[model samples]
Target: MRATVAGTAVTLTAGALLTAAMTTATASPPATATTPPGTTASQPVLVDCLWQRTVRPIDFVLACGDGNSRLTGLHWEQWSPDKATAVGVNMVNDCKPYCAAGKFHSYRVTVRLEGTEPWKKHPGVQRYTRMSITYADARPDGFKQVMTYPLWG
Candidate 1:
């Protein structure tokens, strides 16, 4: 009878320990995830720059900003790999308004680098480019302007 009572006590102690462990495991708080501040969920404008290795011909397309607004001008500068100076520049100023917002008097500048130079080198990269755009308007309050959207890709 004494042995039976001792065995029952041991069994009850083991069961209590197992129940405590399971309760503690389920009661613990879950991990929380967070995102960086000042980051937005808006979609970015799309632009592409194409370069030919043998021909050294650089071609680009400006497909940024809202389509409702017109682009008045586009400027591009090709920089050497070192980024010390510009090798080529092209500017176009023939854009008409597509919407009722009137002609979007704006200038956009884009820079693209192809191949390697004495100062810099890029390998296995199809296109390396940067772009900037600015808007203008003749308003009595002043020239209403908006800068280019920042993109890091």
Candidate 2:
């Protein structure tokens, strides 16, 4: 899939790059706080990002209002009725310029979504029970010891 990643036009192809040297994220709930209110029974609800950079030199940040980390692009490589696997890029904040103005650097990541549970806030709505993020590429600076970030925060 060809999409914009940090303003860089990066193609996420399913192959060795996705299967090799991958970091599987731990199981966790979805970002409930970020999930919009009065959500219906929507299949694959897309999370809205605060910002997305151009893909020329690869510079974009997708702030889903989670406030933990931003991402570039997420493309589902394999998805089924039971589970889904996706490949994307995350830009961890580097407290540069200032904490609020921190810049986000790119890192390849693999995300998995599985398990379904009813949405407590809204009845008749189901959301992913667990979402995981594994470092698919080299770890960014300041994240040497960390491999995955909580799917929900």
Candidate 3:
């Protein structure tokens, strides 16, 4: 009977100690750094799958840049608040006869997006400053192109 009581007391004391430790650990939230006055805080920009359409004419249409490429999928392999590595598939048309009755092809591409800019025409909004694309596999004949912002609008 004495041994049983002692064992019970030890268990209760250990339980009480654990509860007290947990209480003290979470009693207050961690401190955060304050932002300085007149300085803009860096904001994270999430990459959107349909960002292609939003930029239009300036952003290449995946289809051989003949305006026949349709983005089938965009998978983000790695991403942070402001930068990303992504893979995408562009369903392209060979554009025989100006894209009429053209053969459709699938092109695999890897993309990198970086740099941040305050969106023109909109203060306080952020956008990617640069985007680059590389063909993961062989590209269609003479389809190599470089991207420039505000592309041929």
Global lDDT scores for all candidate models: 0.34, 0.50, 0.55
Pairwise lDDT winner, candidates 2 and 3? 3
TM-score of each: 0.25, 0.49, 0.50
Give the lowest summed-lDDT range of ten residues in model 3. Answer: 50-59
Tell me how far the alpha carbon of residue 141 in candidate 1 is from the true structure, in angstroms, after superposition: 10
For candidate 2, the TM-score is 0.49
**lDDT string, candidate 3, 1-153, tens digits:** 999999999999999999999999888542222222332345424223333213111133433335676555677665443665677765777777667888988878776667766654344545566666667786766767533222111
lDDT of 1 by residue, 1-153 (tens): 999999999999999999999999888652111111332212111223222221122333343343433232223242333321122223332244424434443333333333332211223322233333333322212323423332222
Which structure is stronger by TM-score: 2 or 3? 3
Mark the regions of model 2 whose C-alpha exceeds 4 Å error after superposition: 1-68, 141-153
> What TM-score would candidate 1 get against the native?
0.25
Per-residue error at 50 for model 1, in Å? 10
- Superposed model 3: Cα runs more than 4 Å off: 1-67, 145-153
Best by TM-score: 3
- Cα displacement (angstroms), candidate 3, residue 118, comes to 0.5
Ranking of all candidate structures by their TM-score, best first: 3, 2, 1
